[model samples]
Target: MNKYSVDKLPRDIRIEIAHKHRKLRKQRGLSQTELAERSGVSLGSLKRFETKGQVSLESLLKLVFVLGRLSDFESILKPDENLKHIEKLFDSKRKS
Candidate 1:
């Protein structure tokens, strides 16, 4: 359960990510239009994401790639030693 009286975790995270994107954009000295062009994401998408903190994954990926943060996903959903430890949990859930 969430601790806050007004909890909106997904929105909070989205806003944080949006702020990071904006900070990175400024640090790299690129305007919104320039980032959109270099990332191949539509300018409209960029504007909406910055203003509303919402974006499609495809659009986010394009921006992240252009910003050189794609490696941040290196450990996501990877099945290796950690997966082996919890393999039985996965099987049990699947069987039920």
Candidate 2:
């Protein structure tokens, strides 16, 4: 089993992400209500996110920004290294 990738897990990814968020919140010593207030998200939304891993984009964004993890998403859609190498070859062919 790959230790770094969660792709093989049977658990829902949303639940896993929410668990990470919940852990981060606790590590930062923030309560759900306090996180809601600080992040400008509703308490109910925060609770739902932590408990059931359900959240709207706006609420999730607010929470992510408040958590100072906005930059963590920068590589979400970044090309893989092998894809990048192939793209380099493709670009050279196009430029020829």
Candidate 3:
């Protein structure tokens, strides 16, 4: 596996995501307390996530939903368009 594979870089990715979330929260003019109240997430969880990149999926979803960016998560785990096309081609060949 490559030294920079996804499995090897989860920590980095999480930190980056935390940074982006913090930036967006500030851009939206929401303090941590305000966001936590609006999103139904605990202020502790939000602070931990912002400072340490540690948060549960449900809490993260609630935060993003309150930030108006929940739709961005919909594409996660979906097949890539190019991969889908390649799979379709293989399926057609196998059925022939």
Candidate 4:
């Protein structure tokens, strides 16, 4: 199997992301309570996310904003380079 195949499971990805977020929070010396207060997310939501990787997008964004890692999400769902090239080709064909 290819390396990318291992990441096909959303559950795995969510767990990995949660682990990374927890590590970053610890590295920054912020406890869960402190982070929740600063990010305006409920402590219950934060705990759920840390333990189960379940969080709403808005809450996750708020948490990341407080952690200064919101920019990491900027590239998600971006158009692929190959898709852009194909779109350009189609545009040129349509203009002909």
Best by TM-score: 4
Candidates in order, TM-scores: namely: 0.75, 0.70, 0.77, 0.80
Give each model's whole-structure lDDT.
0.87, 0.87, 0.94, 0.93
Residue 26 in candidate 1, Cα distance off native in Å: 0.6
lDDT of 1 by residue, 1-96 (tens): 257666668788888889998998889898999999999999999999998898998899889888888888678777676666588888989999
Pairs in steric clash, model 1: none
Clashing pairs in 3: none
- Candidate 3, residues 1-96, lDDT tens digits: the string is 237564647788889999999999999999999999999999999999999999999999999999999999998999775688898899999999
Q: Could you give candidate 4's per-residue lDDT for residues 1-96 as a string of tens digits?
A: 246675457887888889999999999999999999999999999999999999999999999999999999999999776688788899999999
TM-score of 2: 0.70
Clashes of each: 0, 0, 0, 0
Error of 4 at 81 (Å): 2.0
Pick the lDDT winner. Answer: 3
lDDT of 2 by residue, 1-96 (tens): 248975655337788889999999999889999999998999999999898889997899899898899889878878776678787898999999
Lowest-sum lDDT 10-residue window in model 2: 1-10
Segments in model 1 whose C-alpha atoms lie over 4 Å from true places: 1-8, 78-86, 89-96
The local lDDT score (0 to 100) that residue 88 gets in candidate 3 is 86
